[model samples]
Target: MKTKAVRLYGKNDLRLEEFELPPIKDDEILAQIISDSICMSSYKAAIQGEDHKRVPKDVSQNPVIIGHEFCGIILEVGDKWKHKFKPGMKFSIQPALNLKENPYAAPGYSFKYIGGSATHIIIPNEVMEQGCLLEYNGDAFFYGSLSEPMSCIIGAFKANYHTESGKYEHKMGIKEGGNMAILAGVGPMGLGAIDYALHADRKPKRLVVTDIDEARIKRAESLYRAEEARKNGVELIYVNTGTVSDPVKYLLDLTGGEGYDDVFVFAPVKAVVEQADKILAKDGCLNFFAGPTNPNFSAELNFYNVHYNSTHIVGTSGGNTEDMIDALRLMSEGRINPASMITHIGGLDCVVETTLHLPEIPGGKKLIYTNISMELTAISDFRKKGETSPLFAALADIVEKNNGLWCLEAERYLLENADKI
Candidate 1:
């Protein structure tokens, strides 16, 4: 059988190409992808083409199907995987490939699961027998792809946010009470951080979000409902970096003359690194949420600032299995309106077209519907059914019932399962 994918052919090149697909291995499963949201790294690949690590020289040499964040339904299953998933079942995939137990540890990108941008994906035996991040939820849409991004965000929160430290230090560990600044372009991941920070259990006292695009900042304010984000004690501040000559000075003023307690650098801009150091409060933490492409991407830091002020800087990449699991729970429960982030929706035909214009598109998530025709549904219907899942309702109840224990527990589950899938 033949499968279609958005393949990276050369530098700044991508095409909708077809390939002969291998039969499902006995321990594997075949999935029909529902939807996929684009990530910044994918955008880089779309732009840099051959220079991108995942895009190999040629099909025979090495080939990669683009896209990482997606959700799908089980279409066919082999014997070894039949017990884990059933046909017609909807589930999210934990996209991180590193498995602690496996000898080869073939992460999906390393092997040939292809990508969510394709019409179909073949789940390898290693991924199947170990079990992927599949939750028994009917309303799950684009879970397979989204699992990776959400998991990565959960990992960031886990790495930074803590409840115990909040009560003792009067800081919310980047959750509710501490001040946070996301300095980078407001791509999808940056937008996710904004939502996560705003709706965080302990929420940040104030969230200072920035981007070079003024339109994206406006969209974040309206779509994420920043006006209504005060319940968690989160104060939303939007800054247009395009106009700001000195972001560091601007951030200090926004934080009552004190610098942000925690700053998340999302874009990897050289200036962002320097400003992050300037705008952090004493004993503050700076997280470079976005990874630099250059292998030797290093930044200069002041030792006096680090030693005397007691500041810390850290970076994180793809999340563990635990993050994906928690992300699923967060989506299932309703604390996060994951679908709300999706602004652009198209199909396989538009992958190359939309990807080419990614940097130009402002704000919200862009979804590529690989399995079905975009003509099958209208935009209005798409938006209407977006939040209709019963899981969202259930999650809303969980949020209301006992604060956010359910949410916290859901995250904890992903951490535990990170190694298994």
Candidate 2:
């Protein structure tokens, strides 16, 4: 089989090439990628190349695929896994393959033929053996692609533990009905965290999200209305910290000066991390959810609170398979709408440029259809692009009907109307 993919050759070296795929082995499965959402991690991998932990050391010769948040359909199933999987089944993969030999080896960063950027991929034996490939029954492939990122948010929530006054064992998860704050949290993953906190089983009584950008805060509020979150038993509040005189004091005042029980730092900035530390209540759990590129990233913390208030910190890189399952289940059940996370759409032809300069993009997630050939375009620009192209006109109309957010109808139209790769 032949596949077209965006491959990472070295630092800042990405090539869009068509190559022949080796025949599937007895333990391997063939898949056709439908949708893949570009991630910051992919950008880091593209820039760092061999320096990234997940990328193989000999990546210059043996290039790997460049996407991970993907979902697709099974084209062929090998004999070794015919009973468990069959042709035409939809699937999502948990890229965090914790192999003992290469602990950081993941699908998008480490593999040559199994990354999400390709039109088709060969799921290796180890993926199935490690139980990373999950069967997805969701209607939209984008939701399956989003499941991996949502799982990371879910993992952070689950990893956060609160303590009792006199108990030795730590209680898992954020405190139910407690005050929670997501600092610099108007970004894509931060939006996911807000959705989970509002709709998930464990509900926080008050949820405050902070961002320096007023535009992003407004966008997030428009997608997730405060009224809607209140109905779900959460008092959702979006604050532009840039406008506030003392952001920490203002945030603490929202919780009646008691401070927050769960504080999440979404930005890797040092000041953001310190802000999260300053607003912790007694037994508060600070979950640092951002991944920094710098190896020496550091921030000063209050040791007094650490020794007296029982405030502690925890960080998680990605979610486990079960967390991915939770994400899939939640989306399939129509409980969470991660569509709020995606801000742009494109095709396979745009992967190389987009991956190389993802940080420069202004919007949220950049979703790519691996089989199409369109350039990277923002959802906000659809109406403008519609003047010349009828395809975008129809897409803009559909997105407008869905309150200016990308929907399944938009995906159906784009894939059917756009030129195939």
The candidate that achieves the highest TM-score relative to the unseen native structure: 2
Steric collisions counted per model: 22, 0
Q: Write the per-residue lDDT of candidate 2 for residues 284-315, one digit (tens) a residue.
A: 99999999999999999999999999999999
**Global lDDT of model 1:** 0.65
RMSD of 1: 9.0
The local lDDT score (0 to 100) that residue 174 gets in candidate 1 is 58
lDDT of 1 by residue, 323-389 (tens): 7776777766767655445555456777777776776765556666675444222223432443774
CA deviation > 4 Å runs, candidate 2: none
lDDT, residue 187, candidate 2: 96
TM-score of candidate 1 to 2 decimals: 0.77
Off by over 4 Å in 1: 9-13, 46-62, 99-108, 136-140, 161-176, 241-246, 296-298, 360-363, 373-421
